[model samples]
Target chain A: DTAVSQTPKYLVTQMGNDKSIKCEQNLGHDTMYWYKQDSKKFLKIMFSYNNKELIINETVPNRFSPKSPDKAHLNLHINSLELGDSAVYFCASSKTGWSSEKLFFGSGTQLSVL
Target chain B: AQSVTQLDSHVSVSEGTPVLLRCNYSSSYSPSLFWYVQHPNKGLQLLLKYTSAATLVKGINGFEAEFKKSETSFHLTKPSAHMSDAAEYFCVVSVGTGTASKLTFGTGTRLQVTL
Candidate 1:
């Protein structure tokens, strides 16, 4: 079974359009994270949720918001998307909030904004 | 703050040859280091990790890494390279002080294995 999974692996939308990417993990992990990888291959953390609670929210713009319906799922909703928002978004999960446990990542969802 | 640096943006090796990818990290506290590989059109896979358990860590696909605190380096090495091993590798570091463990990733090193 896929430990972590994200829906809509490929998304294409025009500017100012709203879209949402869904993610779920079945590893019984307490923490889940969202990472953005740009065209240059730089991977950066965007947000993290632990037990359905918002824990780490990086410098992402207010237009991007993450919602956790339960401990097993975290969804990203972007409003008024811009062209620069095009990139690959990855969802990851770990057993603990500590770094000792390795992170398991999803197949990634590529978001392309026009 | 924690940061990881992958010295080479790209590395090429022939089949049956030794594979080496250099990485260095900086952290205020005892950092947890990790190596993740991502094949084209795929997600990142954990290759190996260093959690102060052992300086030498072994991972899948005959890959290993040595963490050296003195040199502040954690480099990945493989005895032999296979064409199937061609992928992008990321060096990651994490600190434990924060409420949620966040990973700091390197710019990634693209490995090209040729016959």
Candidate 2:
């Protein structure tokens, strides 16, 4: 079974448009995270949810919002998407408490805002 | 503060040759280090991790990493390189525990395995 899965593997939209990326994990982990990878392949954490509660919120733009319907699902919604938002977004889940070191990552959603 | 540094931006090795990707990290508390590999257009995969346990950790695909606390280094090594090993490797460091834990990733090292 796929441990972590995210929808919309590729997204292409014009500027000022809105889009959303859905993510789910079947690893039965409590912590889920969203990371953004730039063109240089630099990965940065954007948000994290533990048991459906927001835990870590980085210095991302206000246009980006993350919604965790439950512990198994965390979705990202971006309003007024801009060209700078074009990047690969990854969803990851990890079993907290004992070891939060190992994170299972999704294939990733490549977003292109023209 | 926690940070990770991959000494090399890229490394190229021929098939069957030994491969080495150096990494260094800094953290205020007890740090758990990890090596993650990402193929082209793919997500990151865990290769190995070090958490105050064995200094030398073995991972899949004939890969291993030795943790040197004295030098704050966790370098990934493979006895033989395969073409499939061409991917970007990331060195990460985590300080906090449980849900509080956050990972700091290095810029990444792109490994090219040539035949």
lDDT of 1 by residue, B1-115 (tens): 8898899999999999999999999999999999999999889999999999889999999999999999999999999999999999999998865557789999999999988
Across B1-115, the per-residue lDDT of candidate 2 in tens digits comes to 9999999999999999999999999988888899999999999999999988889999989999999989999999999999999999999998776577788999999999999
User: How many pairs of residues in model 1 come into backbone collision?
Assistant: 0
Give the Cα error of residue B54 in candidate 1, in Å: 1.3
* lDDT top scorer: 1
Q: Give one digit per residue, the lDDT tens place, for model 2 in A83-114.
A: 99999999999887234358999999999999
Model 2: residues with Cα > 4 Å off, grouped in runs: A97-100
**lDDT tens digits by residue: candidate 1, A21-113:** 999999999899999999998999999999999999999999999999998999999999999999999999988778777899999999999
Tell me the chain A TM-score of model 1: 0.98
